[model samples]
Target: MAHKFPRISFFQRWSILFKCIFHYGMIFWYG
Candidate 1:
């Protein structure tokens, strides 16, 4: 699949980065 807009791709990457940061923060806090 291909994205139609570069902005959408950038947003997708940003969201993935945020998710990873959130996951690590949770693990650090509880583990």
Candidate 2:
């Protein structure tokens, strides 16, 4: 239970970061 917490948090943060990057990239490319 203790070890699983960090892994889940890391994945969540990574997903959020990736989404933001992708969004900006698309905006920059289209605009």
Top-scoring candidate (TM-score):
2
Any residue pairs clashing in model 2, and if so which?
none
Among all windows of 10 consecutive residues in model 2, the one with the lowest summed lDDT is 1-10
Q: List candidate 1 segments past 4 Å from native.
A: 1-3
Local accuracy of candidate 2 as per-residue lDDT tens digits, 1-31: 7566998988989999999999999999998
Model 2 reaches what TM-score against the true structure? 0.82
- Candidate 1 Cα lDDT to native: 0.92
Cα lDDT tens digits, model 1, 12-31, are 99999999999999999999
- Candidate 2 residues lying further than 4 Å off, grouped into runs, are 1-4
lDDT of each: 0.92, 0.93
